[model samples]
Target: MSADHYFSADPAAPARPGTVEFSVAGRDYTLAVASGVFSAGRLDTGTAVLLRKAELPTAATGGTLLDLGCGYGPIACVLATEAPSTIVYAVDVNARARELAAANAEALDLAGRLRVAAPDDVPADVEFDEIWSNPPTHIGKAGLHAMLERWLPRLAPDGVAWLVINKNLGGDSLHTWLAGLGWVVSRVASQRGFRVLRVARKTA
Candidate 1:
């Protein structure tokens, strides 16, 4: 059995370069992908649902944004393209994914606004105005929760985080878990067995 996984810090699988083409908000994207990254073959269903259902930022949107677990820069690219005035930081644990994400950003002329970096490489002082992700459930409950615990607090006081989770993969439970952590999480949309969640800090 191979130890390689998309979440692996360093995937042992040889990089087989490819491309994934998908349309979002009427805009077409052809991003570079490889075997070591998440959803290398196509846009992930959960991610697609998140992108389709979430309230995407517009050209007027500014401030820093974060694309957590950004694989190959799909979400990062889209966010940067949609919000021309915003700076997007795409963070991922996988080194190969980071490389592919940076390449994709550069290819789409979004490199100026999109920054790709490994998780630890992101500046600790930076806080995001918006955060987006389709988390890795396969990492198990503890790991997933740890990932959220590490990132959710980095949101600006009024910042919002958009997430998509598979209903079969503890989507509802995750929502409740986030709420238990004091976040105000709501199911903004549900489609194709995926739940799109909008999460924000609770206001007094």
Candidate 2:
């Protein structure tokens, strides 16, 4: 159903909240989940592959970071936790997702550096040093491309973006597509039927 997707501004489903616990980079997390958000049961496999395979930020890392389509803020939380100096913007279109992500950031004591906002709510002037995402490919290729077009340009000239897509769901084709768009794309990692792509502007 079109209404079932997490990109909806408001989900009509019953809240029916619960918790999903998972670990990242050897640290554990227990996050709040409800009926309307993405992967409320556990960490999605694509995200797991992205986190495990992509290059993670370090404490020495600074500047703005974007977690595009951040669901419950798992990637954002990990980013903020690993790179204390970075300010992370966790953007989601769903109201419930923003609320839960904000709460999760607060619970992890990362509220000071993490901002959870709707995609349209983010400040237009912010540019990211690094962008992380497990983009919603189920939205269809055109919509997915539009979402990337809207945010990818915000990456700082020296910045990089990490993205994960299901191989069976057009991963290889998406890589070719990004490359065709003038971005330097690479299949940096693959696991569990997911492709972890590193995307960035080409160097002269």
Candidate 3:
């Protein structure tokens, strides 16, 4: 990884152009990428795991969806493509990543259903039916926890969040921490040392 953080507001590294190709739900995608973005070299392995393992929405699924830490909008595009009626909010902190995500969404003709925004740009009133993220654990435990604390509450009642974490990077600890916080956390899948956690509000 480059010294320039992918989560930086304005990446200092010079942008290097490229494309990342991947398939999801039997659909293929070739997205634009640049240096200083998260997993710019390819569709991140954790992201691919999350997308394949999580319960994808169908067209009948009607509600807002959130792709937290959306890097170039692969999950956002896939969700929009799968559930055309659902509005997908693709949020990230990096300007370059957001720009690339927006461009990719447009190129895929999913601009109408996908909204690529910065962390602070999402409207306060929106409540997501589902939140998908392969969060930036490199941000450190405190930062990662804070990010989750800030966003998980935005989930609508009965909503769920799908997350993929590298086991080496506090995946099990995160599962424990979420449970400690009174959230319902379940390990839905484990592949190549990555844990796919399905989290939801604890119910009575």
Candidate 4:
């Protein structure tokens, strides 16, 4: 596999643009996608599980949200649509992925609510009221942990983060690891070999 694919800051692969269709919260989506981005061909299984099993935001929900490691802005689009009152920040390291994500949001008419940006481009003062992700586990354990450490702290005091991880890819261990880091971790669901975890800050 090319190091430039999916996880790199700038993938060298051709865009080879395409579209991926999926449903969440009884709503259907057809988002723009391309080669060099994660899950270019279709909606990834782990992400499908996450969207299906996790408690999605409702129309009444209102706050700044996050879609970490957002590929072509699937989660970000869904979150923004589900909670029209909220704004979603979609963060990714892959330049091509960010481009595709922004384009997808624009295509879906969610550009006003969903903001796509490179990881470091997010404002320092911004905090998330909720976070959603199907992180890039292929990045390896250390890299994954570092990515989480970088974003999870940005959650508001009462915020929650929903994550889905492949069981064969150390899902359970990741749950334990988050607990060891003093975050409250809960296994919300398990389906199709994926673990849906709800993570939050420890309360007083």
Give the CA lDDT, 0 to 100, for residue 95 in model 2.
88
**TM-score of model 2 (CA atoms):** 0.98
At residue 53, what lDDT does model 3 achieve?
Answer: 88
lDDT score at residue 117, model 1, on the 0-100 scale: 91
- Quote the lDDT for 102 in model 2: 95
Task: Score candidate 4 by lDDT.
Answer: 0.93
Better of 2 and 3 by TM-score: 2
Residues 94-200 of candidate 2: C-alpha lDDT, one tens digit per residue: 88999999999999999999999988889999999999999988789999999999999999999999999999999999999999999999999989999999999
lDDT of 2 at 197: 95
- Distance (Å) between predicted and true CA of 28, model 2? 0.8
CA lDDT of each prediction against the hidden true structure: 0.94, 0.92, 0.93, 0.93
- In model 4, what is the error at residue 66, expressed in angstroms? 0.4
Candidate 2 overall Cα lDDT vs. reference? Answer: 0.92
lDDT rank, highest first? 1, 3, 4, 2
Q: Show model 3 residue runs off by greater than 4 Å.
A: 1-3
Between candidates 2 and 3, the one scoring higher on lDDT is 3
- Candidate 4 ranges with C-alpha deviation above 4 Å: none
For residues 60-146, write the lDDT of model 3, one tens digit per residue.
998999999998889889999999899999999999999999999999999988999998989999999999999999999999999
